[model samples]
Target: MDIANSALRLAERRGAAGKAPPLESSKAQVELANARIEARTADAALEAARRELGLLWGNAQPDFESVDGKLDALPQRGSLDELSAALGDAPLMQGGRLAVALGRALLEVEKSTRYPDITLSAGVARDNEAGRNMAQLGVSIPLPLPTKRKTPIANWRRA
Candidate 1:
């Protein structure tokens, strides 16, 4: 479809550029041919998709002449409150909510298990001849602690 439209645009531009008469006719013919080819390709693709859909439904071969349905018809949508009420008592919706809560709980567990970037080192040195011994211990921890804040803006009001 895009290719055919581009060819048509090119033909129009060539004609507007005051090209030779013969070249204008040739471009028009090419554009027409491209359009025809695109239409045939689109039809074949749609038919193939229909056949594939039939096969997916356990049909060996699709013998339907033409699909009968309105592609533009939109389903009626309920109000938000009604939809919410419907979902509140639905088993599937409840399960989905539970699953989401479980997932979040698991995520929190995973997050809590993460150790902060820190390092600890200990070293001991001894000089037997001098009868001197030194021990050193060091610890390093990251600063500027991470924090998360969430606020709902819907309740905010100007004074």
Candidate 2:
């Protein structure tokens, strides 16, 4: 589901200019995902049909009609140890870490913008008949001070 959301966001971003990346790649990714999901669903349903089959794998495909009844079986906000044990393999923690990593990367990117990039250019020319050889060098540096940082601060504040 997370992959699907990311792929959808990528597709939307690519489509912003009235076009997108090669349709073949996008379609292949989506179709392959759909195939995997269908296979998992079929396998889970097959496994759920038998009593011991359900216990061995613990495939918890919820029944829509019995969802409320199942939830009513548990009390709210109790047993932190059991909750942590159940969430021992949490993907959410990884997501939080990724968010923090991306935040740090964003900070670095902003700082990079604060220090302007430099470009160097040089040219060499010769006019043999005139007996003149000339060499020139040029350096270009963006003036970051003109930006004054206030706008960037406001942007961050707004965010």
Q: State the TM-score for model 2.
A: 0.40
For candidate 1, write residues 1-159 as lDDT tens digits.
Answer: 566667667777767776645576577678788788879999999889888989987896888867777889988999999998888889998899999797667666655545566889999999899899989899998674554633222112221
lDDT of 2: 0.69
Q: What is the C-alpha lDDT profile of model 2 across 1-110, one tens digit per residue?
A: 56665676667667665577667447747866896798799777755555344455574553332222465576677599978886746788778888879876876777
Cα lDDT, all candidates: 0.74, 0.69
Using TM-score as the measure, the top candidate is 2
